[model samples]
Target: MNKNNQKSKDGNWQISFSPIFRYVAVFCLLIFATIMLGGAVLSFSQMKSNAQVLLSNVHAQTSQRIDESITLLESLASLPEFYDPNVPPIEKVKKLDQMSPYFDYLMICYVDSNITVYSDGSEPASLASRDYMQRLFSTGQRQVTDSFAAGADGVTLNYTVAVPLLDAQNNITGCLFCAIYFDEVVDILKQSAATSGYEATLIGSQGQIMSSTAGLPYGEPLMKELQNARVIGTTPDKLQEQLLAAEPGDYWSLQNGSLVYTAYQRVEDTGWDLLCSVDFRTAFLGILPSLLLVAALAALLCLGLSFLLRRYIAGQMHSVDLLVESVEKLEKKLYQDERPENVDFNEIIRLTSDGLSDALTGLVTRSVFLNQAETQLQKINPEYTSALCFVDMDNLKSINDTYGHYGGDVALKNVGYIFREYEKKYDGLVSRYGGDEFVMLLINLDDEAELRSVLEELVLRLHSEIGSAGQQINVQCSVGVSLCQPGMKLEKMIADADEALYFVKQNGKGYYKIHQN
Candidate 1:
């Protein structure tokens, strides 16, 4: 209040406002510093939280896949080869061989030989020498193993899911086995990381990276092979200890000179850890410009700058507010992953049928069948075989003439309905090739007897009278069947099947015949 100064040249009273300006400037600088530093801390906190959630998601998904794999193997073990009393050994080999694209290496091991079955053909070998086969014989229940270098594609890490194929006397006749490459899993983890800005890795029991999108190179032991793993928290030995522990946790470490915050959870039922890391430097980079602006404002305050600096500082603070708001928006979007990574993996059925589903029949189209079946044939593993059936509806024109279009539609729909039922029952792919014509592709059929019986049953069902649009119409179909030979083109197989069906049509209207070639 004390105006102990003289008047300025104009008319205004001028006092030294330096001391008060310094105090007010310092206060403003403190507020600016708080905004900058506090936001960095908050950002890091959000990042760590997000990392934890993401890692948990990755772990849950992996565990679910493992469980699903085991359940599938268990169901497969109950099939004719494994459990049915009267199923002959050769027939068992046939049954086991028909597993589709899913069974990378399917086998039924007897005391004498190991029979490998695939969609292409079968191979008889001494499979008892294989480590996985031996392991399944010992474990008895469903088991999964990793990095087992027993695959044909040289030496790459793969996850093997297996179950003991047993006899009715509860004795192990052999084992049913399949392998999934770890790369498939890595792709899934990468999807999660891309959405949430996290790095993921799967560490084995001995601390080796079984699968990884971060940290030491995959296949190398994490503890011994860690390149430039600088310490961020505890000593190197303790860091190794904590990481190797099969528990859920969060920790800090430095990799390649950048400090990183890490969270990890163990994959249930395996010696694998699902780890996620958030880089401290990257996560907190948003605070740098604000801090620099605040430091400049503090310097201006020291110089006793007034109106210009005040206006500039206000604008900078507003920009900082906008930046903070943007980051918060980002954090929200990253955490909620729709179904939080409800991943429905696309598995195109390699059927010799069409791709697009017929709206009326709700089955695949003809073109889809051919393209996929070709792919399936190309990937044929020895001991695997496929069957192709060409079904020609008899007297469809007559049905159309008698009942008009609606009645004909009913007859066609009935054929599709029966085909779909068999498709689901035998795990085959069937399609509506055209009006009143249907194509059925049966992969991994070990026994022609079973396939014949199924076709015979389906024909009977097709012949059943359907009351539609106030009419009873019997659907008779001519069937042609062809078994795929090794190195056989799907186009050739389809032709043979069509020819066989032509024979059936020429001979009698409603009977099925196997191509005698």
Candidate 2:
């Protein structure tokens, strides 16, 4: 071939490959650009979604905690001795202290006729004869009052809840008052903030900061913003509305020049609002480098694809695969990890495994236990008889008050161990119902004699175990058993058992009673 023809042929080859090269180059650039953009979008969306989910979880957990705490308080309030009018103030204070660990703080103030503060600690001078307390009592409604109360050496914010305690005659007795000191509540807020990766604060119904995790000073700008912001009341519908109405996502700078991404939710039953926020730059800044690196790498890859198409595709596919695998593992860890045996249903299993389990004792929580019991009742075969026993630790609070909460915890754990031991023999499920209360579900307890024998043995074993513990504690429990029958409601069975338990308590301590047929 002539030299000119050879050159022309080579030129044609280059020209033909140019379009393909350009197309490949452009496509690679587009892919890289799309990935970088998509990642940024995904990361932002994930953060937002995660924040929402975390807020939802926080709302649920805190609400549950509050509910549990309140339930404990209500139970204490319902005790005949609490309103006996014969129990001395000092004894009542001691009883309140025994249950104090369940709450951040507690007070048993009287708001009728005069505001007398029967605080667990030193009385706050500013709170003495407070009008808010008077107004709340007269209104016959629960109130959460926020104010600055003078403490021992200084003043601190107070979040006070006033619940009307009713007597057996259905008349309101002195109010059952409880307050959480701002400092202690701040600790809770800080923990929530750390867990959710957000700054958090608890606001009162009037938009006052009852407690704040953020160390930033509360000033005019901050207060103004809080006041102007839409407030969410402690209700499910209101919380949902507040979350939905939140700016799809936005950044706002405080007067002090710190930017934040904030969201709010109302804690149900507590009348307290949870404010979740994170420093905007802190939350988003970490992603910038990866974003930039991806853009840079895309540019380089597009430029180099002219020489190495096969290698590029292989690398991209490998990277994508790894990403997919990582995500799958995360999902597995987050939602599908194996739970312990004996947890029959998925929800119960999840609740048991989750940190929602009580830290004091390795027993199923009240919520989980009740839910599991209900589930078992639903699935129970008519032929397989079961009994629900409600156990109450008599003088448990007295033991705790005398020996301290740590000692109380030890006693409760020992009791749990005894129940577990008894449970083994009877094929029963044992759970710490709450504080000093426990529940045992014994399967196949149809024979009356066998059921009575089990109860007697359980009581004997419990006493023996307590005697061996060598502590200066006198432990006793009251048990009420209700046999599960065909077409019986679980709630009614529990109620019957509870009634029998109360009867045992009234008749004599350290005794067991079965509900009359």
Residue 17 in candidate 1 has what lDDT?
52
Which tens-of-lDDT digit does each residue in 98-187 have in candidate 1?
653444433322322242432224355456666656665676655567665754666766777667777777777666655665666878
Each prediction's whole-model lDDT (CA): 0.68, 0.62
**Candidate maximizing lDDT:** 1
Q: In terms of TM-score, how similar is model 2 to the real structure?
A: 0.44
lDDT of 2: 0.62
TM-score of each: 0.48, 0.44
lDDT of 2 by residue, 107-164 (tens): 4343322345455455523343666566655775665555457445546556565666
